[model samples]
Target: MTETLADFRRRVADFLAHHGCPAGAAPSRSRRPADHVAAARVHQRALADAGLAGITWPVEVGGLGLGPEYRQAFAEESAGFETFSAVFTIGLGMCGPVLLALGTADQRSRYLPPLLRADEVWCQLFSEPGAGSDLAGLTTTAVPDDDGGWRIRGQKVWTTYAHHSDRALLLARTDPGKAKHRGITMFVLDMTAPGVTVRPLRQATGDAEFNEVFLDDVRVGPDDVVGAVDEGWRAATLMLMNERVALADNPIGSPVTLDAVVALANRTGRTTDPVVRKAVADAYVAQQQAELFARRIAGEVRVGRDPGALASIGKLAAGRLATQVSALALEVAGPDAVAWDPADPDGGLWAYGELYAPSLSIAGGTEQIQRTVLGERVLGLPREPQADRDVPFRELRRG
Candidate 1:
């Protein structure tokens, strides 16, 4: 008999408990990026072998061929523990599903298993310095090469784990004469190609979790295209939708939770203080509301509905909750939050959370972008006027 979702969850919890969770801080302290990536690969490989890594994926692609509920079960089980899932975030959450949605059979067969097993890692090349939330403005170009392949040129910024990735899902302008959002193409490119460069970008938390990637004459074959040429906007839109879904479901509200904040207040003897108490209560309410939004998005996904507008709205709510929780954590921790005792093991997490909280607004999509999406898509409001929406990309003026 096949294992049910509950049994699968129990088995996953047991394996993780027995084998030990991903080291609480191994990646941050690793001397080399390769070492950190290797550790993550090993843990992910173990998860895949245990039938827990790609619960919602087809069995032919190194998954259990289970439904989304099984994936949800695993997610719920794993949320309470530390896991080195950061390295696989793009591949599993966005790229893998996108491939499932638009990739040819050969591409899916060739890439999915290795990614699910963590033998290879992937990064997204979407945003550029000039076009983050407004990703359609990206100017990276992919021109036809002599060998019937594409030669890429330009830079990508804020790419997570690009420095350690083996492949990248790239978006580039294929026909600049078309409108900005049109004439774009998405392709899978080898990160190890001769002209590809990955440079780490350090964050406010002092961790180089993201990178700037430069591609010059990087070649990818016609077979590498993910969707119909010049129709990559559809693929990109789907990936961004998944990105919001993944980020929305993250339980770490600004890397801290209401329970943690409440516990901190109690430990600091501030729980009885009216101000702190009220903050905690309000935070609990906010987090709960955000969670409801997340659940609604998740339910849509589970039932084969596109998150659509809910992705934007849910992401905004989650970002706000995360921001609020981060503030509440700092208030509860008081002086100890910013500067921590070196001796305490959790000293870094609090400081890191405080520093990283601000990024929730920027990642996935900015708050303003989310609100705009909600206004236009969900509320049926007219889109704000744009000066260049219909102009040819090459004709648009840029700084």
Candidate 2:
């Protein structure tokens, strides 16, 4: 007999209770970055061994082969724990899912098991310096070699956890003679390969959560190719959709909750202020609305239906909620929010989040990009004017 969802949730809660990482719900506590990553990997491996890592994935891929309900139970049970799984999010949530969808059977069998077990880490190499929103305009080039492999050369920016990655899901120009989107190909490249470099990028939050990756003639085998050579645009779009799901979905822990913000306000003696109280209420409603949108999208995906353009709705809404909650944290924390003394009781917790909140609108596709996508694809509005739609990428001027 199969284990039920309720039983699985209880088991997860028991495991989390015994996990020796950290205990309280405090967010201000900081640990060394390397330590956090290592701890996350170990915890992730333990989850894999327990058949709790990839809840909705196939057993062949080291998953429980259950469904979204099981996954939901695990997430709900584990949310209150002081776990560090950030390092695995891009891999298991975004890259792993996309590879499962687009990769060959050989590729899936070779990669998915190790990935699920946290034996390796992955990063997405999509955004380039000049191609942030217009990702197809990326200039990364992968040329075919006599050895039947491809030599990649380019730089990717805003790559999360790239400095700690084992492999990268890469998009490079393979046939520039074709249209911009048509000429691209997706390849899985070894991050530690010769001539590849990863540089830590400190964000406004004063943490190195992102990296700049440079690939100088990094080589990958034919088996590394995902989808057809020039059909990468399709795979890339699908990957972006998966990324939206990962970003918007509230599985695992939430970004930050309205309750936390209200509690902070109460702690700082702002709860009696009418304006502050109203802001708290408004933030709560926005969060609930976004949560509902995310749940709807996840349900659609669980039922084998594509979110298509609607994923943008979730991403945009979540981003807005994050920004709002973070701003509230700053407001409620008062002057101590920005300038914190160890003497301050709140411990300057909200400061880091306030700085980090602005990026929510920028990452995983910007708010502007999401709105444009929604307008053209979801709302049936006309696409923005493009004179180069028919022009071959080779003939177009690139800045």
Using lDDT, give the best candidate's number: 1
lDDT of model 2, residue 331: 75
Worst 10 residues of 2 by lDDT: 22-31
TM-score of 1: 0.90
lDDT of 2 by residue, 84-119 (tens): 546666898888988888899998999999898878
- lDDT score of residue 326 within candidate 1: 83
Worst 10 residues of 1 by lDDT: 23-32
Separately for all candidates shown, the number of backbone clashes (residues 3 or more apart, or on different chains) is 1, 0
* C-alpha RMSD by candidate, in order: 2.6, 2.7
Residue-wise lDDT of candidate 1 within 111-215, one digit each (tens)?
999998888899999999988877899899999987778999999999988878888899999999999989899999999999998999988977787899999
Q: lDDT per model, in order? A: 0.81, 0.79
Clashing pairs in 2: none
